[model samples]
Target chain A: MKKVALLTAAIIICAVPFYGQHFITKNGHISFYSDGPLEKIEAHNKQVNSALNIETGDMVFKVLMKSFVFEKALMQEHFNENYVESDKFPNATFKGKVVNMSDITLTKDGTYEADVEGELTIHGISNKIEDKGTFIVSKEGIHGNSKFNILLADYDISIPGAVTGKIAEEIEITVDVKLKKFSK
Target chain B: MKNWIKVFVLAAVVGIGVLIYVWFFIYNKPHMNIEKATPDYIISASECYDHYANGNNNETLNYTGKVLQIYGSPSSIEKTDSLTVVVFTFSTGMFGDEGIRCTMLPSYSNEVSNSILSKEISIKGYCSGYNETDVILEQCSIIKN
Candidate 1:
């Protein structure tokens, strides 16, 4: 009990000083699309918590799996209760560092390329993912966008043979986040 | 006897078809109408945060997934392009702040035109699970007379 209290106190004390280097957004957007022969399906999640460190180029993203909203109510229900089992694994996250950190100055206003490699966890499965993203830093804030594709079977998401034709083998994921400097 | 059998069979088929239609179309509907739904718990924002932060196993289990009416003073108000968020942060995260991040429903946009930084308010929403950083709520509506 005492040790846990000490760690909590330590985290509180150290959290503020790191704010200067942290760029954050609570409303990061992520959408996934699957185009099959039968139907094209997609869902979007707008509430994502993400952080990027300008000083070190380390980045992290956290999103609630249940937050992914589908245009069709039936599709949303199937996604949570059937596919993802959101009650069992409520979140999907990515933790990684940008590859070429030294080439870009995040504080200065410019459009740059961000090459990041990270382990992305979805539906209780982790896979190493590498991608390039477009980033813009300006007076308003910073915007980052990345597009990638993944195979469903790789993540152990089983689609019964009955509905295999209805869903695609690979789904496309797009991430867009606007981060502002963290402050008190 | 033959005519009666056909009528019974026809009725049973139609009934099965109607049941499938309702299951696919109506029963599987998402819980979208949050304001009309009853909240499972009415708690202060601090109490809600504390449960996610340091509450016991069942205490934390008791709160997750239920609709909650949280009353608290706002610590920070943020108006992003896509979202109007009100935060009741208690813990400082790796980036300096963490608490309840409530994404308000669109109906309350006019009422909260700008920041309401310190006013005590009650908001109702579905309680999603908490990350180490913050407890999240969605589809929130301000409780007002």
Candidate 2:
């Protein structure tokens, strides 16, 4: 009985850090910029949901298509109605993992380069992506940031020939999120 | 020949005017004024969270992209240098507490004081959609009764 009790206590001690291994942020920020020949378009979505499991190097991000705010209401409308079809595909998601998770310690305070590979889905289509990101570990939280460019055609986001000059073929996406330790 | 020239000149002038109107008014229209917009749904925060938590896809669909006026006491109010976020927590999930997270407009940031904690208040914003854990609202403005 004493041996069983000792094993149970050891299990509890091992599981304590595991419980705090997950990090999450509901109010993450994601923005995309399009530099076209005729026009420059940019939109920002502040209410991004991102979760990261430091133990397993798993990460996921969910962004609402309708949450993207453009400076021009007409462009925003066109984006929802024509470009991305927000009604049909209301969310863009990424399910990926940090390839080099073993190099960084979460308890340590420093910025570490993160190599991420994942499936990014937009407009009901998914594509494999490999990119570099940074994880800044601070006393407050972990700040995750990445900048990458994605071709609209890769995700089946087609632009009409008439307004092709007003929208770029490749869009620059920036992700900035400060994640806090997730405790149940 | 003179009549044709006159007609062509008038058509060109009209075309230019149309292009100007399209460029200044239609193409560059201002964003939605959330302060003046009416709420499509008036609901409590808990009720809103329950709809998503129960996997009521149809019910959740009805609220997405629509303006909602939610009334509830915030579980936590996070004020930062950039924006203020008011969170209405429902239950603990795999990531964290799942609920409605309302990001107030920058102009209304000053109005969300710590004194309003646990006090019922109404906030109106555009419902972006559920991110599995929480229903996000942006361009939020506090509604004073």
Candidate 3:
């Protein structure tokens, strides 16, 4: 009887955190854009770094260095081998918190705009960033959409003179994330 | 008469040289565009394993998936043939309660140290589905960081 009680208590302890509202999806969409005179270059990595800790309202995201695919094979290779050196720095990640987790109940149908602040790491560099997005809480999962700007130089990405006009200094990024509440 | 023949020969030689240069340098150059050529079906490491476990064979244009971020050295599969494969393991879900471990077989060209094996990578390839313990992706190209 004592063992049964201990097991029950352990299960409850493990299940308590899951009772909160938090959902995750491995297949999330994260896209970025950089335009230049020669070409309008756009690349995206679906395998982004992502996690949502419901108990703490902390969300994290990651993307592999070598996963950002542009339109050209040579360009992709250069971006990995020469520019990003994916072998050296394998991933880009973001860790932040949802400002208003208690105010919104994600299980029911509702829309809430939350401010998220976190450290965005890319090209082996980490920077503190803040972004705002709309989060729609549904019975199925959580949907989030946000956009932000990043400077190529901020991450030490140097565009050669030959392709200088082809790439922009500042690029716009759009993220459409959908996370499912973790089943306890 | 001799001078005119020599002049004609010289002109012909230059023309042939120019033609050769155009053929080799202009036309025979690499036409593959890396940015455009990368397979877009970017899938997460765990999802890649799931597809392999289920034995799903579908070649899509691109995949949008997540990168597995676990701290550990990567392990390479002993090569049965000329092609050697590597494996990485991840939990069933990104952030789940129960940690159901799954393995991912990434077909890579270059080799890294065991210590640096967990180098996160996003690979785009033609999914040929599962092969025994490994998932097969053909003609994969590495995306930029």
Candidate 4:
């Protein structure tokens, strides 16, 4: 008990000077499209987890598999149970850096095209990705837009023969991000 | 000697089982409460908006209801040095309207009063009165949503 109290006191003292980095709006939007011979369906979830460090080029993004709601209720369930299995794999994340970190002034308003290189972990698989996007930075906040393609097989996700043609082998993912400055 | 070994092994297994049970179930329960049980003024989202529109200076208001929905994505969830403290943010609003938005901070489970984010969520807490920039929800409860 005495040791625990001492540790607690030490933690409080150490944390006094340190504060939190708040992301005003730390989410984004991602969409999935599966084009079939007869039909093309597109669905999206705007609630995305995203964060950026103004001091460093460090950044991260996440989304809960279960949070992906579709226009059709049955599709959402299939997504969780059959495809995503959200309960087993709760989140997808990406950790990377903005290439030109020093040149960017986030407090000012401007448009920038930069390369973001990171290790993206999805479905318990991690891959190196070098994607580019347009970033808008202003005294107000940060907004980013980008799109890239991902192969289902690259992640070892199988498309059964029954639905093989229904879902595209290569799906284009669009990234729409909006973030706010963390107040000191 | 053989019987003694068997008894020791059984005791070890039972101890491990008890530890696992306590960690996953008993200790994982949420119980953080910010305010004590005292009748306080409770408000609703629409009502809270009305107060802001009316230019009410009262920074505190209580809202009680089940969480109809949780509409934001989280960047990170971390505990602060403070006891049972947390701070995080959701992506700002989408489709044109945007800003700091509303977020759930580190709240005491007891202060929450039976509200779960994934289930029926009712929050009786304080609002810093809506601003064009941010909406703050504090000391809330899950009434039944």
Candidate 5:
């Protein structure tokens, strides 16, 4: 009977960390920049929702298209009304996994390179993407940063002839999020 | 010959004036004035979350891009590196504490700091749609009574 009790206590102790394996942040930051001959465009969306399960290597990100704020009001208006059509497709999401989850240890304080693979959906189009990012594990939380480039044509975001030289065909996106341990 | 020259000069001046107006007013219009604009829907924070939490995507989509005036006690007011965020927590579900997360406008940073917890207050912002777990609002400003 004592042996069984000892085994039960051991299992309970090991299960504690598993319960806190999920990390989430509602205010993740995501920004994109476009460099063209005539102009450079940049926008930032601070209210990004992201979730990561360290144990399972599964991660997800969602951002409202209309949430992206531009430096100029006209650029923002044209982006929503003409380009991405935020009224029709309001949300852009990424459902992916950390391919190299085994290489990183969350309990230890260190920065590890991660290979993330998954599907990114924007403007109602989905594309498989594999990118590299770094995860900094600390006592506070995990800070994840990744920079990648995507072609606007791949996402069906077309530029009008009048502003062909004003917007780039390719845009760079940066993701920065500090995920905290999810607790009930 | 003199009349033709005068007409050409007058046309060129008018064209320049029109170009300037288009550049300043039309092509470079000002952003939406959130402070002066009225809210499209005035509802409680909990009620707003309910529309999304219940998986009513169509109903929830109606609020997107629209300014909302939500009233409730804030769960927490946190200052991030860039801006201040006012959160109205609904529940701690499988993902996390899901609710309405409002990114306050920088101009109202002081007003957000003075916000009392558990005391009913109103906030107005542009509804940016639900991100599965939480309803995101941007350019938020406190609504004075």
Candidate 6:
């Protein structure tokens, strides 16, 4: 009880007051699906950090590259050491804004189609991309989800000839984040 | 006799190659079992948070990508989807927030359920890094009862 109280007090002290305009989630989930000729690979990372500004529709999310847990441990090792190089890059980040911000109504608690555009940095390489998603606001909280595909070659993640058929050229990515209003 | 020997050698070579491939890529390869594995660093959660707050590059270089057994008072215990996350926090920082957050695996759900909240407990997980406020550890498990 005391520790929770103290942590709560600290949160009140240090949190940036975005008020109703800010939403944040520390456990946002991101999963990627790769369909290869030899086999399919899937990995999920739930330790994603995301902050959204409901006022301007600006959003940012980051996931530690090594945080992505794979079903196969060898795949995880290969991913960090060979593909993404998590030791060197550490994280993949997306700093984008909801392009169709004006169309969404946050107070109404309805589904709104949104276009998100910004820089996506993977493996230390940044690329500008635009994608579509949905935003939902309700009395419970705010929810956002987006899906897109990324080519590994675009990020300079090269699959060696030995295992090229075991990996896909374009990996599908899905992002789901639930945010609560930021309070200070 | 020579032809028979050559065929046998080729078969042996192919068998060895397949064995190596299966051993490295397919056999016993999956999510790590952190609960049973030994921790690389045994440090208190508060001390670890202090390093993350004060030490910049050097701190990140040291802790990140390492396995940690962090002990502290549980600030909060919450479940997201099927995963249970035990958070250890300090009331000091720019955000007045710095701590170790451990996400336990599903196999430890029963143990996590029976855990006493607000008590000192130690957990083992991989240190991802300090993300401005909190040091993140994923695929965690209870280490100390």
Question: Candidate 4 chain B: minimum summed lDDT over ten consecutive residues — where?
Answer: B64-73
In candidate 5, position B66 carries an lDDT of: 91
Residue B106's lDDT in candidate 3:
35
Predicted complex 4: DockQ: 0.02
lDDT tens digits by residue: candidate 1, B1-145:
6999999999999999999989876856555688887889999999999887884557766776778899988887777776777889887866458899888887776667445668888999887777667888888899984
Cα lDDT of model 1 by residue, A58-145, tens digit: 8999988878888777777778888878777788889998888787777699999999999999889999999999889898778999
Residue pair clashes in candidate 5: none
Q: Look at candidate 5 and tell me the lDDT of residue A140.
A: 88
**DockQ score of candidate 2?**
0.61
TM-scores (chain A) of the candidates: 0.88, 0.89, 0.82, 0.81, 0.88, 0.88
The CAPRI category of model 5 is: medium
Give the alpha carbon lDDT tens digit for every residue of A1-184 in model 2: 9999999998986765334378888778999998898889999987788888898888989898988989899889989989899877888999999989999888899999999999999999999999999999998889999999999999899999898667689999999999988866
Interface RMSD of each: 2.8, 2.2, 10.0, 15.3, 2.4, 3.4
Candidate 3 per-residue lDDT, tens place, B1-145, comes to 6999999999999999999987775545453433345444445666656654553434211221222222222344323223333445443334442111222223344432354355665544444222223333433444546
**C-alpha lDDT (0 to 100) for residue A49 of candidate 5:** 81
Candidate 4 residue-wise lDDT, B6-41, digit = tens:
999999999999999876645443333333434245
lDDT of 6 by residue, B1-145 (tens): 6999999999999999999889875864556566677888999988888887775778777888788998887777768776788878775332223577788878876787535677788888888777666788876887745
Tens digit of per-residue lDDT, candidate 5, span A68-173: 9998898999899999998788889999999899899998999999999999999999999999999999998999999999999999999998988677899999
Give each model a TM-score. Answer: 0.85, 0.87, 0.57, 0.52, 0.88, 0.83
lDDT of 6 at B82: 62
Candidate rank order under TM-score: 5, 2, 1, 6, 3, 4
lDDT of 2 by residue, B1-145 (tens): 6999999999999999999999888987677787799999999999998987798889988998889999999888877657798889888776577789898999888888888789999999988788777888888999999
Best candidate (score: DockQ): 2
Off by over 4 Å in 1: A1-20, B1-20, B27-30, B55-57, B113-116
Tens digits of lDDT, candidate 6, A1-184: 9999999988874564332367787789999999998778899988788877777777888788878888788788888899999877887888888877888887789888889999999999999999998888887678989999999999999998998767789999999998877665
Q: What is the TM-score of chain B alone in each candidate?
A: 0.83, 0.90, 0.40, 0.32, 0.87, 0.77
Candidate ranking (DockQ, best to worst)? 2, 5, 1, 6, 3, 4
Top candidate on TM-score is 5
In CAPRI terms, where does candidate 3 land? incorrect
Candidate 5, position A88, lDDT: 83
Query: Once superposed on the true structure, which residue ranges of model 4 sit more than 4 Å away at CA?
Result: A1-24, B1-145
Per-residue lDDT for B119 in model 1?
A: 80
